[model samples]
Every structure is written in structure tokens, then in C-alpha cells.
Target: MKIEIWSDVMCPFCYIGKNNFEKALEKLPFKDEVEVEWKSFQLDPTLHPDETKTTFEYFKEKKGVPETQARQMIGQVSQMGKNSGIEFNFENAIITNTFSAHKLLHLAKKYNIADKMEEALFIAHFIDGKNVGNIDTLIALAESLGIDKNGAQQALTSEEFNDDVQKDFSEAKNHGISGVPFFILNGKYSVSGAQPVEFFTGALQQTYDETVSPLKSLSGNENSCDADGCSI
Candidate 1:
């Protein structure tokens, strides 16, 4: 089974959803045969890379809500993260463009380490509160993953994986996905949002049965005759 996840590095729900999805996979018998691909999506593509603002301020400004309301919303999401076993320190999280981070992810995809890169980015942005938009931060992450530092830097600084990142965005738009943490299982079934682990487990089980199972009979075979025998 192939699972494609469209997510943003800075999106808190994306991180939580990833954890839930992985847990669901662990419950499956064919977990080892499952292939996962991380697709890039920016929640704030128009935001400047150099612009530094705390997540609270960004939410307050973008949503035109009171600071109190913004914090309340963030608090809810933080609790959700906790439920998913993710410590989201939105207080220290900086709001910055993630295009460069997405580029670095594409570079990691070449080496089949994109999943690790995605997790590192999530930890950096949500827990460690590092500026994922920073080139140096991305380079350090790639280096930590045993990826070539120079290549990672080059990919971030240049337009090397720009197309691949943009293609993901285009694909999302074409698929009518207007949100983060969208999961497409086997390219046929999709689950939106940071749903519960049970939701993912059910989807995985159903999709696996529908696709991998050998037969899908409309009616019972009790009245039918086969080469071996017929029903009495």
C-alpha cells in the first residue's frame, strides 16, 4: 500500500496526524509493505521567509481574532498534540515560510529519508521551535540525517527541488485539498484532518481488504457450483 501525505512542516496538526497515521500502520499486518510519501504544502506561502512572528501573533493577525481567543484556539490544538504524544510548544514557534524546508524534503526524498526529514522538521518547528525557513537550520537537519550537507544546502539555496515542491501543491489543489495533514491511501481512499487512530486503522483495514483481497463476491457462494462440488 502506498500512502501520500500532504503536510506543512510548521503545521501542528500535520505532526499530530503523522503520529496517529504511523500508529495505525503499526496495527496492520502488512505494515512492512506500506510505502509512505510525504508531500509538501505551505499554509502561509505568501508570508515572507524573513518575517518572524510568534504563532499566537500570526493567528491573531491572520484570523482577525482577539489575542485571548487566539491563545484559546492554540491551547486546544496543543491539547490535541498532547493526546497524540506530541509536545507542541506553540509559544516558541516562529511563523515563517516553509518553501526552503519543503525543498530540503524533496532532497531527502531522493535518498528515501523524506519521512525522517519530515519528522525532524516537525520536531524542530513545533517542539524545539527552530526556524525551519532558515537555510542553516535545514542544512543542519539534513546533515544530522546523514544526507550530504553541501547537497542539502544547494537544494535549499537553489531551485533544485522547487518544481517537485510546487507539483505537490498543484496536486493538492487539483485534488480539492484545502487543508493540511491530508492522507491518500493507495491513491484511492483519503482521510482528511487529524482524525483519531481508530479512524486511520479502519481506513487502512478497509483499503487493504478491498485492494489486496482476492475476491469480492456480490452474493454467497453456497448456491453456486464450482469445479470441486456444488452445494447440497
Candidate 2:
């Protein structure tokens, strides 16, 4: 089974959802049989890379939300994140474009390190409050994950993976995905937001039940005898 997740590195819920989903995966019976693919989706694409504003600042200026309301909103998310074992430092979160980080994810996907890259990006932005939009920061983070920094840098500076990232965005829009951390399980079951662990566990069980098929003879019908009838 393939599980594709459309998310953004800067989205707080995406980080929380990652942890929650991983927790659920840990207990899933068919977890080893599942393949997870991380897709790109920018919550705020128009943001500039050199943005110096924090999350609260951006939300306040862009949405006209007051400072206290923004803090409350972030506090709620922070509490939710803590429940998932993620320590979110929203106070220091730098609001910037995630395009570079998303591109790096496409690059990492080539080396089968997409999940590692995604987690690194999330940690950089949410916990460490580093600017994921920065090329050097991205390279450093990738290096820490054992990913080739030179390769990552080349992919970052050039237009490489740009279209790949955009394609992910386009597909998300086509699917009417208006939010981050959207999960598509086996291309059949869709889960939105950072749902509870039990919810994901249930979805995993349901998908597994619906997909696992009993052995059948495809070439021809086998001779069988039952109380009701006998067939050849």
C-alpha cells in the first residue's frame, strides 16, 4: 500500500501530523507492507525567502489578527504538538517560503531520503526556528541527515525539482486540497489534518481489510464439494 501525504514544511500541523501518523504506523500490523510518499504543498507560496518576520508577525500583518490571538492560535497548536512529542517553538518560527525545502524533498526522493529530508525541514522550521528557505541552512540540515550536501546544494541553486514541486502543488489543488497534512492512503482513503492516532489506526485497518484479498484461482475454477453442492 502506498500512502502519499501532501504537506508543507512550514505548516505546523504537518509536523504534528507526521508524528501522529508515525505513532499510528508503529502499531499498524501491515506497517511493513506500506510505502509512504511525501508530496509538496505550500500553505503560503507567495512568501519571500528572506522574510525576517516571525510566524506571529506574519499572521498579524497579513491576516490582521491581533498579537494575543495569534499567540493563542499558536499556543493551541503548540499544545497539540506537545501531545505528539514535538516541541514547537512558534515564538521563534521564521515565516518564509517553503519552496526551497520542498524542492529539496524532491531531490531527496531521488535518493530515497524524502522522509528524512521532510523531518529535517520540519525540525528546522518548527523546533530550531531556522529559515528553511535559506540554501545554506537547507544544505546544513541535509548534511546532518547524512544526505550529500553538494548534491542537495546543486539541486537547490538551480531550477532542478522546481517543476516537480509545482506538479505536486497542482495535483493537490486538483484534488481540492485546501489544507496541509492531507493524507491519501492507498490512493483510496483520504485523511485530513492531524487526526487522532486511533483515527489513523482505524483507517489503516480499514484499508488493509478492504484491500487484502483471499486466495483465488484465476485460471479456472477448482473442483469443490460442499454440503450445498459439488462443482468441477
> Judged by lDDT, which candidate is best?
1
Would you estimate the TM-scores of all the predictions? 0.93, 0.91
Tens digits of per-residue lDDT, candidate 1, 1-232, equal: 8899999988888999999999999998989989999999999898988987888778778868888988888899999999999878888998899999999999999999999999999999988989999999999999999998888878888988999999999999999999989999997899999999999999999998988757877887787799999996
Q: Give the per-residue lDDT digits (tens) of candidate 2, residues 98-156.
A: 89999889988888889988998888888898988899998998788777878878999
| Candidate 2 TM-score, C-alpha based | 0.91
Could you tell me the lDDT of residue 174 within candidate 1? 98
Deviating ranges (above 4 Å) for candidate 2: 213-232
- Residue 152 CA error for candidate 2 (Å)? 1.4
* RMSD of model 2 against the true structure: 3.6
Clashing pairs in 1: none
